[model samples]
Target: MQWIEIVVLALIQGLTEFLPVSSSAHLLLVPLFTDWPDQGLAFDIAVHFGSLLAVIFYFRDDLIKLTRAWVGSIVGSGMNQEARLGWAIIWATVPVGIAGLLAKGIIETSMRSGYFMGYSLIMFGLLLGYADWRYQRKFSANPASANSDEYHLSKTQIAVIGFSQALALIPGTSRSGITITAALLMGVNREASARFSFLLSIPVIVLATMLQSVELVAEPLPVGWGKLLAATAISALSAYLCIRVFLALIRRIGMQPFVLYRLLLGAYLLYCFY
Candidate 1:
């Protein structure tokens, strides 16, 4: 790949991976529009691994605390909030994992159509916008009433969000977007909803990378080693910065900005493909 293609695609993967804007949709559409050849699974794995590391690095402190608490609880130590949250994250990842396994063939074969991607982009965008508006209105009436504890997701909420995550298998139903939208519609605060959505990503990315790695074990090396390294570095840096900025931005603006972006992007894609 040319340097320009490397940079653009890597940046797109990094920037959209965490946001509710659907990284998969952007990745899919870019080559479609630009007439570039598919990046192939090897390069896809490399960039994804980069984004995975970015999320893990950014949340290192929280992961450490959650890990220690979770491990301690397993050993019969007193359970705490972080420990419970840790287990909740594990429980919540199950639905998506199962869905990925069961639907992998169908999703890969039939769900990559641009028409479906466009529809999901528009429909999910409107739903997300409505959820954000509803949340703001409901919270504004008694903004001072919520304590920090209310942000932590209940068991039922986690299950609901987990189930919703399976929708991400569709071409434009972004994993982060669907998960965050579900959390918000279910009454999670913006920051907490984003936090959980990102946390849920860790296991999913790891599983995906491992699965791809198995396929790559016998394949010829993809691209030059040097190019792969450069792409990985770019992916990591871009993704880390994207996560930081997105989290900070959501605190200030809620999800409306991203929702608007999705709406415009969907409409443009529909025009192009439909």
Candidate 2:
């Protein structure tokens, strides 16, 4: 990819990664529409790493507190709220990690193919819209006034959300979208679901990026390190800003706008590709 293409792709990756709009779908569709060369495994790994850094930086203090609390709990001290949250995140990551490992090849072969991109877009868009509708109805009927602590998810709920995340292997099924949908279905409030979803993403993204890096190292691409570094830097900066903006928007307008956007994007993809 040219430098300009790299910048555009990185920006797209950063923005969509946290925006509930499916970063994978945008990456695939943007390249298709723009006539850019496929950003192969190396580029993908770089972008993921960039977003990983963004999240880490954004939540540094919370992460430190959680880690310390978790360690203390392990040594027989009473766990604090942050420590319990840390444990919940750990529990929620398991299903996705295992599913990603087992289905890695299958997902790569099937969903990542350009042929399936349009289908994924339409299908997952409808699913997200349905989920949002259900969540809105339930919330309107009996609003949740409880805080995160009060609605702390059980292990079963975590497992279910984690398993739902596996569906996000498809290009249009945003990881946050699917997991938040699961959490909402399980009765967690929207903001709490979103918060936990963001926290849960740290480990999963880190491990997946590491695995992708290993694959890239096994067979170095034609691109040089300078290009990789530039791409990653741009992506990281963009992702950081994206996450901030998304969180603000969620607090203000809720997720309905995102649901509408997904549906329209999906329809556009179907029209263009099918």
Candidate 3:
């Protein structure tokens, strides 16, 4: 890939990764539209690592507390604030982890097909729109108590959210978008849902990136080190900014705008494909 392509891909990866717009969809579409060379598994892993760093940096303090709490909880110590939250996160991750392992081959095949990609974009975009609308109604009808524990995600809720996350195995069905939708549907406050969704992403992304990196080392891509470094830097910088902007936006306006954007983008992709 040229320097320009690297920059563009990195920017897109960073921005969409957290924006509730599917990063996988954008990664596939951007290259298709721009005629850039295939961004092989190595580049994909590198960009994901960039985003992983952005999230870790953004939530450094929270992570430290959560890790300590989780370790304590594992040893049968009394649960603390961070431990409770950490357990909730682990509970949420279980379903996705199992599902991803079982369906890896099927998911890979679907991602390789443009038709499945277009269909998923349109379908999930509509799902997000409906979810946003429904969540608005729930919040307006009965707002959550201020004193309610923000870290609490019931076992059922975690399972439901995890099931929703499995949908993200589809190319255009974003992990963030689907998880947020599930949380909203389960009566989680929009801001809280988005926050949790982001937190939940760290483990999955890190594991996936590491595995992909190993694969890349075993069978190197055609690209060089220069291209890889440039892509990683661009992805990290843009991802940091995108996380900041997205968190602010969710606070201010909820997820409706992102839902609308997803819908429109999905429609355009469908139109092009059809």
Best by lDDT: 1
lDDT of model 2, residue 27: 73
Clashing pairs in 3: none
Structural similarity to truth (TM-score) of each candidate: 0.95, 0.91, 0.93
| lDDT per model vs. reference | 0.86, 0.78, 0.80
Once fitted onto the true fold, the runs of candidate 2 whose alpha carbons sit more than 4 angstroms away are 113-115, 145-151, 221-223
In angstroms, give how far residue 215 of model 3 lies from its true place.
1.5
Candidates sorted by TM-score, descending order?
1, 3, 2
Which segments of candidate 3 are over 4 A away from where they belong? Answer: 145-150, 220-223
What are the per-residue Cα lDDT tens digits for candidate 1 across 5-84? 88898899999999999897788778566978887777888789889999999999999999999999999998888898
Quick one: best TM-score, which candidate? 1
Clashing pairs in model 1?
Answer: none
Tens digit per residue, CA lDDT, model 3, 184-231:
777777778877888989988976887777777788447587888888
* Minimal lDDT window, size 10, model 1: 144-153
Put down candidate 2 lDDT per residue, 34-139, tens digits, no spaces: 7777778888888888888998898899899999999999998888888888898887788788888898888877777544666665666666667667767776
